[model samples]
Target chain A: MNPLRWLVGRFPTLALARRNLSRATLRSALAITAVVIGVVAIGAIGTGGEAFKQDQLEAYEGFGGTATVEPDVQFEDGNLTNTELSDGDIDRIRQAAGSATVLPVHEPAGSFVQTQSGTLLFRARVKGLENPGEFYEARNGTMPDNWRRTIVIGARIADQNDLEPGDRLRVNVTDEFDRSFEIAAVLKPQGFSAPLGADRTVFVPASEFESGGYEQAIVRVDTTTGSVDAATQAIEREFNAREQLVRVEQVQEQREQFTEFFGTVNQFLIGVGAISLLVAAVTIANTMLMAAIERESEIGVLRAYGYPKRAVVSLLVAESTILGVVGAAIGAPLALGIGMAINQLLLGDPFAFTAAGLRYVGIGVGFGVVTALVAGLYPAWKAANKRPVEALD
Target chain B: MAPEPNEDDGRWQEAGDHATSETIPTDAIIRGTDVVKEYETGGQIVRALKGVDFGIAPADFVAVVGPSGSGKSTLLNLLGLLDVATSGDVRLRGRDVSTFTDRERTRKRKETIGFVFQSFYLIPTLTALENVEMPRMLDRTPTKTRQRARQLLERVGLGDRLDHYPDELSGGQKQRVAIARSLINDPDIVLADEPTGNLDRDTGDRILELFDELRRDENVAVVTVTHDDYVAEAADRVVTLIDGRIRETESRRANFEEGPDP
Candidate 1:
């Protein structure tokens, strides 16, 4: 006897079994729909949450470096600028750690820039003076040479004060010093910077900062030289013996935190999906149970013809698996569509739906088949055990 | 042990030379020695068959007749291997079949026995040809079960009704399909539990005639359970059962086409 032929021979009975299940079409459809909803929900929520978190991380990447170094131990509200690395300390760190580039920065005193229309208060963060674009580029004009009393205003600040690329403005430095500066350019608003408030800030050269001002040192490590972790550990060991407040940020730390946060949020989505899948499992089980009971006579007839008990069970399981496969096949794309729709509506960005969701769909279908098989166990056994005479009667 | 033949009984000893090659030599086509069957209902145990002894030879058409509660149906189920005897042994073709499991019984039944239920238990969803092919499906017999089923239907005078479902067919047609199904496996014994019980008188007589033709021409053993004497008279031998015991056994040569036998 051909194994293939045997399987084919049994195919008709399976088809008949599916037809028997269709007698209760509404109940079976409800079970399939439950599976569909679970898969779709998981896909949409899980993918959407991941995209949102990535956007959040990307917005913060403009913080000048892959990692930052600060005082390892500092009391809250204490002045970090006084204890952190200064210009000379930054030069030493850069020379000491050959592979890393450290940029020293300071926050100058807050002052008001007055335009023809109004006056707006803006705090200035100072970085190394260079071909100023090397420090922080502007949207319109070039950086001024020789500290020609030129300033690059923020877009919001420029809008508020009606400042332009060639306009001259008065920069009053805590009233101790005052200077008139040319507005070299306007910078696009970088979302929330830690030291500077939202849009109420500006950037200037570091050479102008006086003594006893607050400042920070940002380090960018080259990953090709060595492990970020090894570099951080070496830096900590070198700085540990000194009185200086020296802290380091390993780029790996940020990546790890990103993964941890994403994992936690994805777990939550999976939990929600699992609960719905469990409900789908129950629905599948209930549907199979009802079908098994309703077709008791039909099952008995098959058994009388010498069909094995295993075959009866297989038929029921196969029908449920087919339904689940069909549902998941349709639901997967629906889930992607839902994710795209949500991304566009909520974040103003279209997201990608990956094929990784196939793993989840396969799990859902497998669960449906096993649940149906388990549910039909007792009924299938009863049908197989029925005495032919009793069944006929 | 073979029991001595009673006087005046056609023992097959003197007429042994009449045995044709087509006739199955059933020294014990169906043999039950002191068989017993008990049924428990509502906490009361009722004995349905009580220490009964009987054997049906191959090519012999026999009838078991009794009142409704006299265990005729129970005896039919036992012979068909659909039910087990509580005590004693049943040997089919000299093999002790009493100890067989349900699966084994199904196998043996498919190999050598067939059944026709009084209710015409054709699968309601299947057409007449499909219904007839159902029994043959058990053996995986090649050569197109569907075509053989069609031939069976044609033989039963329902060639045009092959596609009709059980519900669509008349009562007579359904019984004919049931008869066709019983012959599909070409079993040695056809155990029919009141084949004509649900039909009108004329149809019932026609079905009996069909049974007679199958027994004489195909050389198949037939055990029919019926409550009507007219139906019993159509058989070559009749055994009367009362309260689950064999009360009497009688032999009559059925001159069926000519007239009723004495």
Candidate 2:
């Protein structure tokens, strides 16, 4: 015997319920299809959200241990006092941020850069850092340990000007400083989530500028050891001990904000999906009611043959539950297939799945069955409780 | 097993084994004492049965016969424990049925009485064998129920039609299936309402013969509420009702040991 038949045969109520559902194949199939659509809606959206989140988190990998500290402009008597972080502040930050690398930054006033060939002049960001090797990787040449008159330009800026190492470019800072410097290296392009717009910035030696105070400071640490968190807390404490002196923000916080925002969106979408499922529940209830009404005389005969009201109720509920189970069984896999396709298209890995994805699918299936049970209850009770004579007549 | 009495004697008698003993037998499977059944239709009290006395013993073939608007179906419902009497008590196996709780009454009805209706009432989704096994499905083991259902169908001479759906079977075959279903639980009494009313004369006669065989062989009391004169005449006793009261009770047999074979 088929396992389902064997199982149904083992229980009379299940056998009867199955037989009743099979009597109207189209209505049952339509009811089940409604449930399937509802399940797929919830599962696929949740799965797609998780995949997008995973993709973002992966993009944020390289910037995990980095944080930025800038002067928190203090407004007293309607005047800005603390506009930039001073050297004393940098020393205090280094002292507080234990075991984390700190680099003070300078912004030079350079309008545009003309290549050594003098072919074209384009605007570019001018950043002065003491050691470019600590923060950036060289794609074409090398970043030196000892910094002098050498410069590193972002790959985009180098490509735009057709510049390479050993080539010299003039910095248009002021009329007094019109000297050209040798190109040390061309820096690789930073990822989308990388801070500082590193892909388009021009890097020069900090010693070349007579800096009094810096605009920003970069803090780098090993994130796995809780060093990033420790450094952020220490820097915040040191700068804002009495009053706000500087603002400290970690790159991971932005990623977390994105995650939280998507979490809310996912829940809202699931709620919408749940509403569709409830609609399916209503359809299931109607189908069950129709079945009960159509089989009123049959139910009367069962009752007259000594079947209790509870037996009749259970039989009807069992049929509705069967409809839900079968629908969810099909819908879960279909949702999984869609999710995998989405993951493969978006993240290039079909198997890139998360617990949340599975959980959503599980929840969809669970709700499908629960809605069916809830839907069946009213019709089952009404049908079973009808007077035998009334039903028979 | 007790030997079946000779069933060929024709005599003017008072139905069942109690007639020879001169009083209603205390061992009667079911009894009604002035059972009065009423219905309130549109604020008017419509009495379906008015203080009628009736009883049936084991192995008795009793037919309730009456004209339309007489209380035959109402009394049948009360006797079958399918409904309650308005003012009197209907007893099952000498116990007052009104005193039993709802569940207990249902259980008693299930275990003690079988029913065969005019339309056969077979579930269309179920095969003939499944319909036969329906009553015993809950209380009996599946294997035991199936085995007995098979035996009953074979006894009813529809052994080859077990797997057929109700629609697939003819009117006579469906009635046979219903008869087999009625015996599946081995109830003490089988109450049939218009059992042969839907069948042709030839098929109805065969159904009557099947009822006779069931009553004699199974030792079950058969009470049939019907309008067919042939059914009334074939029964061992006939209870005729008029205007919600029992007008007369006629017997065709003196006791269980004497009756005519089909």
Could you give candidate 2's per-residue lDDT for residues B113-198 as a string of tens digits? 88888788899988999899998777637777788899999998998988999999998899889888887767778889898888
lDDT digits (tens) for residues A1-393 of candidate 1 = 577545534465554555555666788778779778766766666666655555445545554344566655466665534354655666666665667665565544345555544454544332323234544456667656665457776666667766679987666556334566677877655444322332455555555545532355555565556444555666666676666557677544665576677778778777787687677767776776676666666565555544556566666766666666656766677767776776675456665433443444445445544544454555555555656566666
Superposed Cα deviation of residue A87, candidate 1 (Å): 9.3
lDDT per residue (tens digit) for residues B1-262 in model 1: 4343333221222224323222222365678889999999899999999999877766667889988899998898888877888999888656688767666777767656777877776776667987888765534443466667788799888999988988899999999998988877666688888888888998887888788777656656788998878888777678899999999887664323334522
| lDDT of the candidates, in the order given | 0.65, 0.82
Ten contiguous residues with the weakest lDDT in model 1 chain B: B6-15
Best by lDDT: 2
After superposing candidate 1, which stretches have Cα over 4 Å from the reference? Answer: A1-10, A34-65, A74-244, A264-281, A308-357, A370-375, B1-26, B138-143, B227-230, B250-262
Task: RMSD for all candidates, in order, please.
Answer: 8.9, 7.9
Give Cα distance to truth, residue B116, candidate 1, Å. Answer: 2.3
Clash totals in order = 1, 1
